[model samples]
Target: MVVVIPKKRRDGKSSFLKLVFYLSFREDNPGDIPVTADAFFDRPSTSKIAVFDRLIDYIDRHASPESQHLITHLPDGSHRILCEGVLCQTNTLSIETASSEMNAVALKNTRCKDPVYHFFLSWPETDSPTVEQIFESARHSLKALGMSDHQYVTAIHRDTDHLHCHVAANRIHPVTYKVADDAYDISKLHKASREMELKYGWTRTNGCHVINENNRIVRSCSKEKSMPDDAKKLEYYSDQESLYGYAVRECRPEISEILKADSIYWERIHAVLIRAGLELKKKDRGLAIYDRVHPEQTPFKASSLHPQLTLSKLVPRIGEFENAPRVMEFKNEQGEVTLTNYMVSSHYDDRLHLRDHQARMTRRLERAEAREELKLRYQTDKKEAKCPSFDAKNRFRTLSMTFRFRRAHVCVAVRDPLMRKLAWHVLAFEREKAMAELRLKLKEERAHWYRAPENRRLSYRVWVEQQALKGDKAAISQLRGWAYQAKRDERTAYLSDTVIECAVSDDIAPVELKGYTHHIHRDGVILYKKEGVTQMIDRGETIEMARPFENEGDNMVAGLHLAEQKSGEKRVFSGPREYVEKACSLVRDLNEMGETSLTLTDSLQQKRVCEIRPQDKPAPISFDSPNLTP
Candidate 1:
């Protein structure tokens, strides 16, 4: 077992130190005292009962059944106490009585700086010692520390993987009444730990001070071949260490040549190491390389690989070397040698924060890109899916029919399955061609408008008026209201002009709804945003866009309005009132005309409602001749 007595701190206010102070005298459980002892005291208990009560409470709260009783000198006046289970009960009354007895003796001597001393004796993770052995060890250690006759309590705590004991000693001796001195405490602990390690046949550990100084390197060494296997230990070393291990084992000669040569060129060695996935960093402990992929792993130490690679030896050969520009160096505090400053720059902290931010943004971008790719693939797959081959014999026989629109009709013979698909394709082709012409016409008109200085002046005057109204609301109340009305009027006119431009571009062709009129604005069309929804002007009033709702009552009204305007109402229905009232009339007429619907199902009529894709279209199927109808 290894024993450690932590360094005493001047800061007495720390909570952890306070816990250790109270835990030493606490009872393992409430009211469970050994039956063999006689209660005796020399001093009054009034001045210190509460201190002992709090100590017992800390123990009871953290206690288990086995370590509750206090072990002490046998009442038979023998040196050894029974260590099986029972000691004095650690409850309030018993603790108070013991403190009074100790205080009575302490009153005879001068007060000490610390009246209580605590020690921790920890064993190996694999070992499980009995309570008797642990108390015995604590007894022997106390004797070694020259506190053999002092009254003390030992509690074995088994909460961690390693079993340990906390021993608290009252500095005042019961007989001598001399305050205990802790001079050379650390050295005594080291000697006692060595003695116990030999006695228990457990692995020995150096004093805590020595173990911490070497960065816990010696602690990793077991009494047996206690270090973890090479693969596991390598994780604690830097990437350079791993590469050094491999290189020393695999290519020792080349590395030796580079190290021994005067006026060493680092690039040559760096290039060689980079090929093997290694890069050197001048660290506080000397040259090391961290793994590129697992930088959290400790860097491999070059000196550890071979003594010649030590900073003292390597620096002489390299001579007047300039370290990597980004690696800052600082003078050694001990005046030994220069060392790399791993934590010197304030900007490095900001850089780390920025790197974390960039990493989060990169992950978001990757997810967004993945979603977009999936959407595109889905659309492509849907387009590539072939329509179920149309059949005429069992499903629908070909029939000569006349399809009529207002003042226009066509007669043809087609199977029901093919008829819907054929008509949709014809309409799509016509619409695409008309939109192309519309785009060209819009470009020409925009050019013409920009060429007119009067149009530009009018736009600038409107902007200036709006800005003036916004600057001082109180001064321009009536003018502001008038300006707002004028702005609305201007927007309405712009929307109406856009609709006229569309009409002129397509040569007054009837508008077809392909669901593209919402959200997006083409060259000749403008969609105004309002109340988080897209809006457009049909006449003078604002109309909410619903281009995709083709079979709805509102859509039918829009289509009728388009068709009637194309024929003769084009010049007459220019104002908002005329356009809105005409649309209401169209909706009434359409409702009176009744309704018709074409329902397509998945299994039998899946592809009948789709427009044709030119690349995947089958050979043209000729229609049978029929008499024309109008």
Candidate 2:
């Protein structure tokens, strides 16, 4: 597995944030991971002035959906996880690319040994930490890490019921007021998480590393096949008078001492042969042939055995032999034997972290694009029909009627089928994301109503209109919230351009970044860093922004200023005593007029109750119309 300790550079930090928030993905995505930034943010609903605050609030919410994210397996057997998307990042991120706020995280005076800001962890959808469980665990972990900032952890979009938890952390320790170098015992966090995953019965695999230099290559001999097999051996070559004299004088004593440990070690003396110009490898072994004619580069001929001796001739002359070795021996019919054996060494390889990071980025982007595509499915008009005849106050009473009028996607059983209907669950979150794609078998008659010609339409206008009925003020507030959120998102997009710098491991050449290395030590990389000259992220980078001119709030006195805003009307209505006193005569008249309708309804209900008392109560209420809309 590869874990990257990203360099703490302000420029890189900018790009990191930018890549995270400006993320894009296809709304029709079939895989997981949010590629585009919008998948993590809420659409803007508030005025530009408040959008930043709305975004920040969202980021802090610790959002969670029914299932956290979708997972896609790559061809190489790795995976990508697409977490639920958001409408904005302003709620969680403090750096405003805009002018009103300081980009404190991007300061010049800050020491940045550890600058980890936001974290988004995802796992396969097939296995997971339950939404509630994840919420608790994430909160506990973040708090244990000493991050009490509520805004830092969020379980967003649970209402739409997609699963995903996000944390936006400040790398600097608030209490110590020290920048976390990330060189600390951060493994403890992952270990603890693994323990928790085990406790919760979740599957976990921390993937593999993929660097080019960590693998092996083959080598070939310079004049291998051209030489005879017998010519490949060079036992008696050292027996030559001059060679034997030089070896006895310069090396025989040392060689004899080493041979004391293993007499057969000479069988594996290929390395020595190569050095003395008698052996060559078979493939492209990263070494070049120095001289084909050199005895050192070519094999020694067996015919050149010293003293012109043969095995039988030498053995008879040498007489008795001691220490007959435990070599691999084969017996003939007469029990005479011959011996032979060979050996090779054993080792494993390693990979690079940078290569892994780039690969991960690529896979992540692919899955993100898919989830974004699904998000656009929401733009289609597939909302359940509303029953104007029935009041929401008694939603349950119209169950039967709703059934009759229900759309294909609508279901009304109290039983939660989330487990059985994974697609339905997924779509629920996608719908909340807005203006995304959802594939559906089209109803020819309903084609015009769907967003795409193949299916149906979901209108942004209609959603707003229906919610508007909740309360004029509430609707307006929600709208403004969305508007404000959009602005914050634009600001966060600025962080994607920062530059980051980190070095290669010492055992590896600097060229390893773009080339390759062969050595693989038992110990992994020893991280050494070059601290940047700056100490803090610049907060002033964004402070110059003026108050939004177009979205400025009403400036008149509180009550009057709110009139056009609609919320003012609610405030005035709360003072019923004063209004009632002013309209006392009108109220009296209205009370007398309401008795006619009230009396008629009461009489009809009484008659129905009397009739149903003898049998069953009549269906409590009629269903809303099947073809109705806001």
Cα TM-score per model:
0.32, 0.24
Return the top candidate by lDDT. Answer: 1
lDDT of 2 by residue, 403-475 (tens): 3343234454324576436655555565534222212212332444443422323245334323333322222
Q: Which candidate is the best by TM-score?
A: 1
Worst 10 residues of 2 by lDDT: 535-544
Q: Write the per-residue lDDT of candidate 1 for residues 1-630, one digit (tens) a residue.
A: 677675555653222224333444332211111111122112223223544455566446544535444445444242322122323212122432445544455557765545667777888877777666776788777887787777665556553456777776666777777776788776677666666666666664655323334333232232212223353344242111233344444334566677666667656565445444445677885787544334665565665544565667656666543443343446677875377633321111101111112223343344335434534644565466443333323222222111123113322344465665677567656655655665666567666765564333222223322322233211112122222222222222232221221121111211334442422111112233334444343321122234322334354344344434432212222235433343334433443457322222222221322332333333433455254333
Runs with alpha carbons beyond 4 Å of true place in candidate 1: 11-111, 172-181, 206-314, 325-630
RMSD of 1: 39.4
Whole-model lDDT values for every prediction: 0.43, 0.31
The TM-score that candidate 2 achieves is: 0.24
Could you give me the TM-score of model 1 versus the true structure? 0.32
